[model samples]
Target: MTKQSSTDEQGDSQSGSARSWWLKGLALCGFLAAIGVGYYFFADQLSLKAIAEKESALQEYRQAHPVLVYVLAFGLYAMVTGLSLPGAVPLSLAYGWFFDLVPAIILVSFASTTGATIAFLVSRYLLRDIVKSKFGERLSTFEESLESEGPFYLFTLRLIPAVPFFVLNIVMGLTPIRVVTFWWVSQLGMLAGTIVYVYAGHTVPSITELAEQGASGILSRQLIIAFIVLGTFPLVVKYAMKRWKGTDARN
Candidate 1:
């Protein structure tokens, strides 16, 4: 190649490589920031008593400061989710009880989706290269499948009980799914659980009962059942779709 042509080609390659590295750096920064914030907020875990206390005060505070409460609560919910913390589920249900399922589900769904997207972006940016390097061969088949079935695969994992959702959130980040795709899919996928939890909150007769249920272990059986049902619904939907398609073909 001529010197001029070779230099031009080298410049293009360098620019492309630099852009890739920049993306990697941004993702790493986000991931680390999330981890740091997670540790900061959740470092000294609150006791059930503390939860109960907060629950009782929630009503009075809401009554007293409606506007600030709404803004603060929504932002707090987003931050907790973005950081992949534990208490977001309960808070969603509380919204259901306090306002209603429609608003609660809408709010939490949007917030959670945004948070998951943030988490996903972080994973893709910072960890994808490392994960690909280590797990390339094993992940190759999975990656190919992801091109076709990634959304449903991700949806199933989201629906499944006992999966640490935050782990899934970040793990998904390293996948090939685009961030916009992840956001919409996650919003829809998480809607059912948000509905269930928010509905549960509406059933709570009193704020006191709501507080008691979380700790007294009363809600566990109910939540377990709900999760089991939630987890199975997608499987049922998938099967019905297949059965219907097969029947159509036969006809």
Candidate 2:
């Protein structure tokens, strides 16, 4: 009876997993479609040409429709993560040019975390269980190693900025890390890169003409360096704490 019950449970789990994957596939298709449509509609606005022509107009739209702006920000972050897009970092630099540091940092942090979490969910929903069941014996070794210090590795991957955020998300999702842990660790881990990008965005001028006309003051090199330091503050604090702990151990 116990063996029969175990079999029933496994069957139910597999069925639910199949249903989830079907839903995930549909969602993936919809998300890709939306991204393409969005690019088509907003291409002109985000282009350098539009930046040259309608700076104040775009600024006004952003100010008046702050919520809409954030959604666009979220979509941009998610697409970059999902598709492993190449221009994400440069776009981060654009954030500083268009928005103040506070808004830029807040938007990027939330947008990146949300996008990464979505990638994690998408990966787990579509592939994790199937992959595990198919190669359970072979994959267990990989899972065992990553489970021990997954958060640390994740943080390092985020700092490098070379590792695609979505790639990390899907790869980590395939491991044994808990979703709750993934969300919080990813939030903290990604903050460094996000702030770097936001600071870069802080200096971007919306209109080349204004910059050329001497209407906009680009941040001095000194100021940019200072902003970069400010963004690294949390990591600095963590290092200080660790060093202090080491001294205490010696005492």
On lDDT, the leading prediction is 1
Write one digit per residue (lDDT tens) for candidate 2, span 89-153: 54565565777798888777776777777777766766566545765664565466467645665
Model 2, total clashes? 6
- Angstrom error at residue 36, model 1: 1.6
Model 2, CA-based lDDT = 0.66
lDDT, candidate 1, 1-251, per-residue tens: 89999999999999999998898787678667876876677644323334455675777888899888767767767777777777776677667777666777777788778777766766576677765676566456545657766677667666664446776666666667778877777777888888887777776766557566563433667777887889799899778877998899999
TM-score (C-alpha, index-matched) for candidate 2: 0.64
- How many clashing residue pairs appear in each of the predictions shown? 0, 6
Instruction: lDDT for model 1, please.
Output: 0.71
The TM-scores of all predictions, comma-separated, are 0.74, 0.64
Clashing pairs in 2: 93-201, 95-201, 96-201, 96-202, 97-201, 97-204
